[model samples]
Target: MTEEAEEELAEAIQLAQGLEVRGVNLANEGKLNGAMEEFRTALKGLEKFKRRTKLIRARIHYFIGNLHTLQGDLPKGLQEWQKAVRLDASLTDARMNVIKSLSDQGKHAEALRHAQLANSQPSPRVEILVMEGDECKALRNFTCAKLAYARALQANPRSFTAHFQLAVAHRDLMEDVPALHHFERAAEIDPTSSSVVNALAVVRGDTCQWGDPDFSENSPTNLLSVFATRDIHDKASPIHPLLLAYHLDNATLLRVVVDSQAREAARDAAVSVGHAAIQQHTNRPDPHARPRKMFSYKNTFSAFW
Candidate 1:
């Protein structure tokens, strides 16, 4: 309004921006303490300008809270975030940060409450639902986790993460059949994700459905079974190479079985047997290749002569 007030406002805004830049630079350099100091300095400048701009004041508090959060000072971060929210309830970043900080502190109930509040303001993002599901899972509340994951899947049916997490929730609850199905679905959606493939393989093994006729007929059941068995024996067994070999063998066997359609189903079964033999020879050490045992006698025939 007044020229002098305008000049003071401009100076305060410039100082806040400068402090923010310095804080970001310090944070990038891993100087969390220095960054926090700069953020505090920015907050002080913005507070001085708050009489003219409440929005800028809220932003400064939010950024300060973010800096504290990055430094693992949850209480201080939450306090500042709460202040930011008090100033402007529409500060979604502040609300989300507070929820994350609460969740990190193992306050899942409170975190869920805040998450619900945030969602009430607007439709929550898929990532928020995922976070909520993870927290519920960590708290051993599988039902709530499933619900959250289900909501995420409903929001986007093609979300591989949602399917994978839902599978994990089901597995935790010992719902192996559903877990196996969802795990396989996730692997199908994200074939390049080794974690997904490995998880699906684990669920399949746990369910002992590798021998299931439906999947065993055409799936990589045999190869996955061998891998699972080897892993059970030696936890350090390399799986990726074995899995690759298994896939190749499976492809070759599939072609053989298909081409042998004119023959009986027994012929298809024989193809599987041959594929197993090839896999064993290729992936396992040869038993006959070991040194032969030498036989010894206590008395010789020459002694009798």
Candidate 2:
């Protein structure tokens, strides 16, 4: 493209971005129809620019997809996201959304195909690789999942999700030593993450490495102490339930198991209560009431990039 053409494309993209911001604000204000109109208007304006506006067009489609899902039209939402990636192969967020939606709908093979398409992009995102690993895991292709996660780690060494999931992939393949190493790294990276702490503790206990002086230099010698010191009533779910049955005595294990069950039951009860409240509010709309976070879709969609 000529310099003038490049400048025109940039100007067009800037206009579309402004429209996207307006659309997002309207959506946040619970004006779904207005948001949809703003997005469609942006799409119509971009149509004339053709290939130059491909990325922005894809983004607009992705936003439209989110709006569709917000309006409880999931199938239509999926179609919009699919249209997005077809417009621009490098639209990472749109492709990731497609991969996740397909995987959630139990279309693992299709998700894998989209993930592989990311390889064609100049620099596929680390999150895409992680999701690729996830799809592989769903398909019972642990080796493939491991490879994807390893690539993700190579791209971002400190990604807690990659390390944790890589550990899990290793565990699935019965590679205890590598799993232990990754789990330790994951725990170190995010000590407050209860799931990682639990996984690390369980692996150490199972491998008879608790308090072993030869633990990794990055890991604490008394790693199990961290798990032991955590609050007994932590709300986060355990990543591995097998931790309950691992190294504790029968009585202590029984008490811990009962507490965990109680916590889960309480959580479920709270969710039910919240759902009931939401339903009641929906049934009686208050025109004067300000919008609150009834759901997190707005935040989630913004964070896609």
Query: What Cα-based lDDT does every candidate model obtain?
Result: 0.62, 0.69
Model 1's number of clashes is 0
Model 1: per-residue Cα lDDT over 239-269, one tens digit each: 2222222344454433432333224334433
Steric overlap count per candidate: 0, 0
Runs off by more than 4 Å, candidate 2: 1-18, 211-234, 238-305
lDDT of 2 by residue, 25-85 (tens): 9988889999999999888877768767777788889989988988988789889999999
TM-scores of the candidates are 0.59, 0.71
lDDT of 2 at 117: 96
| Top TM-score hit | 2
What is the TM-score (0 to 1) of candidate 2? 0.71
